[model samples]
Structure formats: C-alpha cells, structure tokens
Target: MASILITGGAGFIGTNFVRHWRRAHPNDEILVLDALTYAGNAANLDGLDQVRLVVGDIGDTELVRQILRNHDISTVVHFAAESHVDRSISGPAAFIETNVVGTHSLLMAAKAEWLDRGSGRPHRFHHVSTDEVYGSLGPDDPAFSETTTYSPNSPYSASKAGSDHLVRAYHHTYGLDTTISNCSNNYGPYQYPEKLIPLFLLNCLRGIALPIYGDGMNVRDWLHVDDHCQGIEKVIANGRSGEVYNIGGGQELTNIAVIDAICTALDRAFVDTPSLAQRFPAAPAANGQPSASLKSYVTDRQGHDRRYAINASKISNELGYAPRRDFAAGFAETLAWYLENGDWWSALLDKAQR
Candidate 1:
C-alpha cells in the first residue's frame, strides 16, 4: 500500500485535509504526526481508525526518520507551522523554529529516507503554503500568480516563505519530487477561534465586542477549507514537480464586509437569543440590526497586509482544478458548521489559554 506521512494533521486545515484525503484515497495508508499544540486537538481525529496518529514535533529528526522507516512512508504532505500572525509577532522564535527549522529537519529526514531506498520508485512531497508570502497587493496590481515574487510582511509569512524555498531547493538539489500550493485565506470548521471569521462569530454569539483591525478595509480572497484540500489533491496528483499552484476562492471581500456578512448570518440564525435581544430587543426592529452593532475597531496588527487575492488560472487551466466551493455558499456552510459544532471549538478555546 502507498503510505503518506502528514504533518500537523490535528490542526484546522490539516484535520480537514486528512478527512478529505481518506475519502479520496481509501487504500493509501496515512500516518499523521502532530505535536498537538494549543490549536491541535486529538478530538479532531477521534474516529479515523485508518489514520495512525502520533504526537510529536516535525523538528524531531530522528523520530521522523524512525517513523518513515517503520511506516515505510513514501509521500509527505507538510502542513505543520506556527500559523497565527498575531502569535508570531509576540513569539517569532517559535515560528522560526517550527516553520523553518522544523521543515529543514523533516526535509533532511525525508531526503535520508529517499537515499536509503536508492531507487527510481516515484515519491512525492507536498508543501502546503499561504498567499501571505506575496505580501500586500494594491487594488489594481492583479491577483498573486504562481510566479509572483515573494514579499512576506509578517514573521509567520516569512517563516513559511523560508519553508517554501527549502522545499523547492530540496527538489532541485536533492532530486526530491515536490509540489507546492499557496492558498488564500481559509475559513471553515476546526479553524482556531483567533482567526477573523470565527473570532467575530464567537464574539457576536457571546455579546462581546467584535474587534476589527484598523479601519477593517483590508481585502482577502477567502477559500473554504474543502476547496483548499481539493486543490492540494490536484497538485499532488497531476501538478508538475517543483511547480507552485495558487489556489484562490475567486471571491474577494474587504474585512469589514466579511464581518458584516457573518454578523448578518448570526442575527438571522439567532433571532431569539438573549444577546440579540440586548442589541435589538424589539418586535418591530428591521430583522438584523444588533449583530451589526457588535463591531468594535481595534489597533491593527503590525505589518498587516492590505489585500491578498490569488490568480488560480494556472491550477484551473493546467490541472483542471476548478474550485467546487464559491465564497457565498462556502461561507454559509462554514457559518453553519460553527453553529452546529460549538462544543468542538469552545472546549478547544478554553484549553488554549491553559
């Protein structure tokens, strides 16, 4: 059986990707290595017997080497990283350690494993990345393409950019078959509450102030987690080695607009909640007023990128990788998932501080 080693499989995108992968490739063996960090939850992978979950850091070179040998892992899909920009600003050292050094360790281990095999048998390494590596874009600069120059602004993005370069170098210098995909902002179930959409959703639910950074006009192309996983599958299955594909939602919205949309969804969903009554407790009110009133602007993050969009033409045209989820439907489904699964993340958020 073809074996794949996936890092960060307990986190948001990682968990969703694992689920997606299992369904698409039922016969493949999946070995998930995750540190179970604050954001990574064992509960996320609770029912998947097909996956072997191991709690460990990707930085543990020897451990990774052992896992590769024991499992006979031939493919790797790396998703491990310090992902939150706010946290990265407060503690950049962790970001560097995990995103850069950890990737290096994993790559070295994989290289050693490949060398030990010493054959032309096909193997692939898939690197999952973000569009933040392209930094901010003006309204008219067009979306970031696969060929866009790297201009990472935040420490998190910079670290990920470093990892991306390392993956490319491994492909060129070490003859490792690797594919990279840089995706736009992802919003869906299992995402940490610290991100924009979930944070606002929770804040609105609890009657807390919804914090918007700066004027909240920064624009981002939002991709659903499922769409991103689909893109990764396409890249892994059909993409040219050492090539980067940009995966975009094809729907762009300002930060303020996104918050407004969530608030609208919440208000419509919770017409009888106490928070809604406190904000707009009137029978004659125009349906959705209170959710919009929860907005509370905060100081913007340092080095916050203004706008990010992706030119996904290459993935679509070349690999026939059309996104199945559009922004409106995907956002609606995401909001529904959060509402239906409050216990999952509420417990996670409570434990994250401890």
Candidate 2:
C-alpha cells in the first residue's frame, strides 16, 4: 500500500483532495501537514477516518524529512502556498516566503529522502499550481496551453511561477519524479469567503451590497474543485514525470455573469421558505432584477488580469481526464452547500475576527 503526504491538506482544494483521496484509496495511508493559516480550517477534515493531520510549516526541512521517513511516504502532493492575489498585493513577503522558500525546502527534503535513499519503487511528486502564471489573455487569444510562456502579473502568481520552476529544475537536475498541473479558478464547498464566489454568496445572503471588481467583465475559467481533484488523481496515476498539464472546467464566465447566476440560484432556493424574505428583505425578487440591482461595481484590483483560460487537452488526451461537472449544476450545488453550512463558515469568520 502506498503512503501519501498531502501538504496544506486543510485548505480548500487540499481538503477536498484529501477527502477524495481517502474515499478512493481506503487502504492507503494518508498524512496531512498544514500550518492552519487563516484559510486552513481543520473542520474541513473533521470526521475523516484513517487520515492523520500534522500541523506544521512545510518550509521546515527537518520536520518534512521526519514526516517522510516516519510515514514512509511514497507520494507527496504539494498544495501549500499563499494563494490570494489581493493579499499577495498588500504583502508580497509572505507569498515569497511560503510559495518559493517553502516549496524549495519541501523539494530538498523530498530529494534527500526519495532520490538519495534510492527507493526502487515509482514515487511521485505532484505539484498543484494556478493558471495565472501565464498572465492575462486577449479577448480572442487561445486558451493557455502547456507551452505558454510564464508571464505572471501578480505577486501570488510570480511566487507560484518561481516554485514551478524549482520543481522543474529538481526534476531535470536530479531526476526527481515530478508533475505539475496548472488549474483555473476553483469554486466549491469550504472555500474561504475572500474568494469571489463564496464572498458574493455570503454578501447576497446577508442582503449586503455585492462588490464586483473592475467593470465586472473580467473572464475566468471556473473549475469545480471536485473535478480538479479528480484531474490531480489522474495525473498521479498516469502522468509522465517532468511534464506539466492544465486542468480546466471549460466553464468560462464573466464576473458579473457568475454573480447573476448566484443570485438567481438564491432566489430559487428561498422560494419555499417565506421566512427568508424577513431574513434578507433585500434579496432579489422573482424577476431577478433587484438581485442584479444589488450589484455595486467597485474599484478594480491592482494588476488584475483581464482574462484566464486553460487548454486541458493534454490531460484529456493522455489520461482520459475530462471534467464531468456542468457549471450550472455544480454551481447550484455549491450555493446550496454554503446556504446550508452557515454554522461552519460562521465559526471560521468568528475565529478570523479573534
């Protein structure tokens, strides 16, 4: 049985991945290492069995080495990073420290334990990354393919780009088995409120003004977190080492369009509950006008990319990977989850205030 170490396993994507992996590989051992940052919630993994959580920093070389040796970890899925673009804009130091330095330290530890020890078995190191590393796209530009040159526009993507290069360097220089998958924007359950989807959902539920960055025309390829997790698993199982793949949901929409969809979903969800009108009187009416009216265009984010699209044909052709979730259906399900799981997210917000 293979033992896997998943870094940042308590964060949004990491949490979903851990849960998915556990369900797929019940007999395999799974260990999670997370720092429990603002975005990392242990509750995401609550009630999960046969999965151990090790709260620590990924940059700690000795700690990582110890975990690898003690757990006999045969696969390392690296997802630990500072991912928010706004946060990275305000403070780039943390981004560099965590995304670049932390990734380097983790790579070093893996090299020492896996390569130096000469483990005869086929070991894998899968690095989860973002498509923002390719910078913005024109109105008619083709989706970003694997061969797209790095043109990171924000501090967050720049740090991730640096880490991606490090992973590639280690593979070519030391023959370390590594694969990287750059994915589009992910939205699903357990996502922090700072992101666009959850934030808009929460704001709309509370009858607060929904803020849209820029002219609300920024385009993003939205990927369901579950589909993204499935793609990662496929890569781990069939991807070639020293290669990069793109994972996308193929659901391209503008910021305003996504917000409108959320509002419409909320309207449908509350149709049966008359008491919800009293709760959020400002919610959109049946005509879908007021909810769209609640939209308040705000100042654009600094260095915000105009568009982001991913060409996932490589993974689809090579590993038979195709996104199965329809955007409308997946998005409606995600909205239902947030509406029903208020207590979970409320607890997180309460902690953040403290």
Candidate 3:
C-alpha cells in the first residue's frame, strides 16, 4: 500500500477525490495538507479513518518535505489553488502567491524527497489544472486538446497556467515523475456555494435573484466531480509520465441553459413532494411561481471566456477513462444533495457572513 499526500484535500474537488481514493484503495495512507482557507473546510473531510489532515500551506516547502519523508509518501495529488476568477481579478497577488509559488514549493519538496535524498524511489506527482489555460474558444472552435497553446485570459487561469508550466519544467529539467490533467468545470456535493451552481441553488431556495453575468451565453463543459476523480485515478494508475490529459464530462451548455435546468429540477421536486414547499418556503416553485423568475442579468466578468470545451479523447483512448454521469441524472442528484443537506451549506453561509 502506498502513502499519498493530497494537497487541498479539504476543498471541493479535492474532498471528493479523497473519498473516492479511500474507497478505491482502502489500504493506502492519506496525508491531507490544507490551509483551511475560505474555500477549504475540515468538515468536508470528516469521518475518514486512516487519513491525517495537516493544517498548513503548500508554500511551506519544509512542511511538505517532512510529510513526504515521514509518511513515506510516494504520490502527490495537487489540487490546491486560488481558483475563483472574480477573486483573482480583485486580488491577483494572492493568486500568484498560492497557485504559482505554492505549486513550486510542492514540486521542490517532491524533488527533494524522491531525488535529492538519492533514494530514487518511485513517485508520481499529478497536477490538477483547469482548461481555462487554453483561453476562450469561438462558439464553433474545436474543443481544447492536450496540445492546445497556453493563452490564459484571467488572473486565475494565468496563475494556473504558470503552475502547469512549472510542473512540466520540473519533469523535463529535474526528471521528477510528473503528470498533469486539465479538467472542465466540476459540480457535486460539498462544493462551496461561491461557485455558480451551488450559489444559484442556494439563491433558488432563499427567493434571492440568480445572478447571470452579461448575456449568460457563456459556454462550459461541466464535469461531475465523481467522474473527474475517476479520470484522475486512471491517470495516476496508468498515465505516461510527463504527459498531459484532458478530462471532460461530454456535456456542454450555456450559462442560461444551466440555470434553466436547475429551475426545472426544483419545480419538479416541489411538485412531487409537498414537504419541500415547507422546507424551502421562499423558493418560487414552493409558492406556485416559476423558479426562472429569479434569474437576473448582471455585469459581465472581466476577461470571462466565451466558451471552453475539452477534447478528452487522449485519456479515453490511452487509459479507458470516460465520464459515467449524464448531466440530467448528475444534476438531479446534486439538487437532491443540496435539498436534503440544508444544514451543511447553511453553515457555510452563516460563517461567510461572520
């Protein structure tokens, strides 16, 4: 059994991956290192045994080195980053510090433990990245492939691109066994509500306006967090070193289309179950009104990409990776999770206010 270090293991996609990894490989030791920032929560990782969480930043190279040495960690799954585009625009420095500098620190420690120590032990460093690094695509442009050129538009994407380059550099210059996977947008349970889907879902329950940026025609490929984790597992288990793979859900839709889908789901739930009306009394559907009424157009995000789609054929052909969840079933399950676990997300809202 291998001991693995999971950076940002308490965040949305990271937490889901931790849960997924545990189930798939029960004997592996998991060391989770996280800064517990606004987006990362300890509760997200609650109820897992044989998993130790260290509250710290990845920028602390020494801390990571010790974890690698002490735990005998053979794999590092990097998921930490300042990922929100709006936050990055308002404060780009933090993005650079965390996404770029922090990633470098992790690479440094991985190199030290596996290479500098002269142990030359088998190690894998898998960097998780976003497809935004490829920049905006025209509505009819082909999906982003592994060979897509880097043309980041936003601060967040730029920082991630920088980190991606660092990972590739480390592999070529230092011979560190590293792989990278760029994935599409992910949504599932335990996701921080600041993201579009969960945030809008919460608003639907509270009778608040669903804010749609600009014309809301922006297109994105939506990947279920579980499917993304499965793709990552394939990459870790069978991917070639120094190669990049793209993971996608095969579901592309406009921003307005997504909101409309959510509205339709909520309306159905309220109709099928009367108790939902009592639980979420403020919901438009609960009060005999259409949920679509809550949609409100707002200012567009600066440098927002018009479209992003991933050509996942590389991973699919190489490692037999394919997303299993269809958008309708996946979304219905997501809505059910949010509806049943109001307390989970409510706590986040309450704390954010404080």
The TM-score leader among the candidates is 3
Error of 1 at 258 (Å): 0.3
CA lDDT, every prediction?
Answer: 0.88, 0.92, 0.95
Model 2, residue 244: distance off in Å is: 0.3
Quote model 3's TM-score. 0.99
Which ranges in model 2 have alpha carbons more than 4 Å from their true place?
278-289
lDDT of 1 by residue, 247-325 (tens): 9888899999999898777767666454534543331122445677878889998999999999999999998987788
Q: Show the lowest summed lDDT stretch of 10 residues, model 3.
A: 324-333
Poorest lDDT segment (10 consecutive residues) of candidate 1: 279-288
Residues 1-354 of candidate 3: C-alpha lDDT, one tens digit per residue: 889999999999999999999999999999999999999999988899789999999999999999999989999999999899999999999999999999999999999999999997899999999999999999899999999999999999999999999999999999999999999999999999999999999999899999999999999999999999999999999999999999999999999999999988889989999999999899999899999999999999999899999999999999999899988878988999999889989999999999
Q: Give candidate 3's error at residue 2 in angstroms.
A: 1.3
Which segments of candidate 1 are over 4 A away from where they belong? 272-289
- Taking the tens digit of each residue's C-alpha lDDT, what string does model 2 give over 1-354? 789999999999999999999999999899999999999988899999889999999999999999999989989999999999999999999999999999999999999999888776678999999999999999899999999999999999999999999999999999999999999999999999999899888777766788888899999999999999999999999999999999999999999999989877777777766666765565665334456567898899999999999999999999999998979989988987887797998898788889
Ranking by lDDT: 3, 2, 1
